[model samples]
Target: MWIRALQAVLDRGIRQGRLHVRFPDGRMGSYGPGAGTGPEAQLMITDPALPRRILLNPQMALGEGYMDGGLSFPSDDDLRGFLQIAARSAQSGRLPLPMRLAHGLRVRTKGLMQWNTLHLARRRVQHHYDIPDAFYALFMEEDLQYTCAYFRDDAMTLEAAQAAKMAHIAAKLCLRPGLRVLDIGCGWGGLALYLARAHGVHVTGITLSQVQLEAARSRAAAMGLSDRVAFRLQDYRHVPDRFDRVVSVGMMEHVGVPQYQAYFDKIHGVLAEDGVGLIHFIGRHTPPRVLSPWFQKYIFPGGYAPAFSEVIPRVERAGLVVADLEVWRGHYERTLRHWQQRFRANEPRVRDMFDDRFVRMWWYYLIAAEVSFTDMGMVLFQMQIARRSDAVPRVREYLYPAPGDDQRPSDTA
Candidate 1:
């Protein structure tokens, strides 16, 4: 009975591509058009009860089943191909009745689910970022920039692109010597150290994760910038100093919907009257919606990538002006693609670190995130904000000078 139910769900969810399924009882079934049509994928079910679980909660069940060795593809390459087809189908398909109801419930109750109180926020940060730092070093670039890289040129390597990302944000901040800067959600002190070394600024970076705090401080000391840069294991809300510049990269998603006002207020409070800041985050072009059940449960608990509409109002209410907003389409997709390749290349190392289950989970996470940026409405938003309109340059040209224009915007203008 459960097998029949799952087949019906798949028939509706995958009309554009073929999903060939081999059930636990050796019964074969296929959904969508014949093999000659669009993209095709095949999977085998190893557990008899998996069908009922998937029927109840397709997203969560599928991730868990894959991790637990209950669901698998014919080959490693087939896994990515299957995910692509599934993502495309989900973009244009409807969930089953039970799943739809559950999705709606999550959307309606998202505020409660993502409250993210101070203590709760710390716990959630440790849940993901506290994973052994060595494990992350295997896949990430030398700088350990876990956020999206700026691909200025299509041919740039991951390391070059990450450097470009820092330079891009630094340009927006309009740095000068002896300026005081604050780095919120500073990951590994990369950006803070960059600001100090490149711009000759004094930087204070804050994070909730102890591992990140230690790694960031050690990097600062090694770079001989400890005097110019500082790392703290503190929340943004508790900050009490003013800064000439502020920047947060890939950090706002964890600031829950309920805390949006307070988050902005904290930024507003700490920013000088003439301060300029930039926030880089993953945001959706679509209307605000609940986070994916699988992602929230297994990856980023209490996290939500918000819509621009959900953020702009809070910025306005905080008395902050949006100096500029840039949408980066296809950049994160490429970044995730690189990370996925690196992860696959180091699959043996990862498996040795944990087990086969951890390998499957990470693989699913990387592929799912890549597909989200590709097929879904996900994109990166680089918002330049200020306490006053005159804090930044009146023209956007300052952000993008000619190739050989090496001087600062103020110096050139």
Candidate 2:
């Protein structure tokens, strides 16, 4: 029964790419090449229990089994390629109705177990970000940007791509000297310090992770910007001042559906009348029904990636205008490719930090994230928001510096 169920899932899910599975005792089967040709993937399941596991829940079993060594890919990177087919099969709506309905009912019938309440939020943030700095240093660029990096060109290095991302945000913001900027969910203070140095903006960065708080503060002091930028280990609700600009990059995803109204309301209360805000986050094409069970259990405890339709209404309800929104495709796919490459290259070092289970989980995390953008409906959202309709220029031309305009760093003091 389990073998038939596994084969049936592959037959329906894979339409374009080839997926071959080798069961124990020398039995083998293949799917795809019946539609179009692209990449082929092979999986070897050494443990007999895995077929039953995959039959119960293919989505969660693939992740859990891979971490447990029950499932094996040809290579570390091959799992990423294989997930591409799986994600496409899942998202393409080509599956039989019963399969779709069964999965839909599963997600729809359940409620999220984790909520980003103050205590839970702190714990969640710490669970993910409090890994030793050396672990992150192994994969991240010099800037240690844990979020998405903007790729200007295919040839740009990770370090260069990350720097361009900061510049891109700065461009959209139209920052001028001495503007007070509030950075919600600031990761390691990278963006905050960049804004202060590049635009002379005074930045107050708030985060829930003590690990990030101390690191960001240490970096600011080392760079002699102790007075210019501040990092606090606090929640967004406790931030005490209104700012001329607000930015929450890669952070709003954690503001679960339950907190959407309050999240935007806090931003609304603290934004200056003429101030504007930008939020960069991972979002889905459809309304998010619930968190991924494996993701919720292993990586982020209380995270929810809002859908376009789900969030805009809440932002509008907060009395903020959605001035402009940009959907970034392919960029995050490229970003994750780099991270995955780095991770696989340094897997030995990471294994030294944690057991093989932890390493496997991180590998799965990187591959899953990369393939989500590449194959699933996951995309990045950079939303430009403001209080008034006329706060920003009528056109995007102003966002681009006028010829010979001084976008350069100066005594912005």
Candidate 3:
């Protein structure tokens, strides 16, 4: 019964790519279109119980099966290639009636899943970000910008693109000498130090992760900007001072549906009358839905990539004007591809640090994120907001000046 149920899922879910499967009973099966120019992968199942597990919860079981060595790819097509096919197929196919009901139920109960109390928030941040700095250095650039890097062009290196990202945000913030800025959810103080050094502004960065707070403080001290920049182990709700500019990158996803109002309210309260703010976050184009069970259980505990419909109303309630919004469609895909390549290249080092299971988990996490952007209607939103209508320039000429007219740092500061 389980075999037939699993086969039914595979047959319906994989219409575009060809998937060759070897069952535990020594039976060979094939799924997807017989004739197609698409990703072709071979899945070998070693554990007999995996089929029942997959049928019970396909999204969670497949990833767990791969990590536990119960399932593996026999062909050169690795997990990334297979996930690309899976993501595309899921995007094109309609969800079954049961799955649709489950989705609706999840949407209603999303707040419960993402309670994000102050204590729980800290614990959750530590779960994902408290890993050793050396582990991140394996795949990240010199500055350790863990968020999405901007891909200006196809040829831009990760380092260059990260610098460009800071420059872009700096321009949107309307920076000037002596302006006070707040960096909420600052990963490692890269952007804070950049703003202080390049734009001559004072920055106060707040975060919940102890590992990140220490790393950020160390980086600021090393750069001789400790006086200009400070890193605090505090949540956004506790921040006291107002700022001329406020920027949060890749942080809003963790703010959760329940905390959207409080999150924006904190921003609005901390932002001065003439302040300009920018929030860069991953958001979906579709309506609000529950996150994957695998993702919630493994990668990020309290994270939710909100839909714009769920986000905009909160901003309005906070009395902040959405001055400008830009959708970054393929930028994250390129960024993840770079990280994936670098990670696989350093697989030996990663294994030395952890183990094969850890490596596979991280690989799956990165690839699943990449394809989420490519096929699942996920996008990066760079939203420039303000308390007043005229806080920024009337036109967006400041964001993208005429080539050399822009004085913002395009390279590492």
Best by lDDT: 1
C-alpha local distance difference test of each model: 0.89, 0.83, 0.87
Ranking by lDDT: 1, 3, 2
- Candidate 3 lDDT at 157 equals 98
Question: What ranking of all candidate models by TM-score puts the best one first?
Answer: 1, 3, 2
State the RMSD for candidate 2: 2.4
Indicate which candidate wins on TM-score: 1
- For model 2, what is the alpha-carbon lDDT of residue 349? 87
Per-residue accuracy of model 1 over 1-413 as CA lDDT, tens digit each: 99988888888888666778999999998888756656677899989999999888878888999999999999765676677777767666476667768878999999998998899999999999988888999899988999999999999999999999998899899888888999999988899998899888999999999999999999999999999999999999999999999999999999998999999999999999999999999999988877778899899999999999999999999999999999999899899989988998999999999999989999999988887787668999999999999988888777788778765542321
Q: Candidate 1 vs candidate 2: which has greater lDDT?
A: 1
Clashing pairs in 3: none
TM-score of each: 0.96, 0.93, 0.95
Greater TM-score among 1 and 3 belongs to 1
Give me the runs in candidate 3 sitting further than 4 Å from their true place. Answer: 75-78, 92-97, 407-413
**Model 2: per-residue Cα lDDT over 220-320, one tens digit each:** 99999999999988999888899999999999877777788888999999999998899999998765755567888898877777678888888999999
- In candidate 1, which residue ranges exceed 4 Å CA deviation? 34-38, 91-93, 410-413
**Candidate 1, poorest ten consecutive residues by summed lDDT:** 404-413
* Residue range 1-413, candidate 3, lDDT tens digits: 77877787777777777888889888888877847657777888998999998766767888999889998886435566677777777666454556557656877887898999999999999989999988999999999998888888899999999999998998888888889999999998899999999988999999998998999999988889999999999999999999999999999989888899999999999999999899999998987767888899888998899899999999999999999999998899899988988998999999999999999889888888987887788999999999998988888776776776764322223
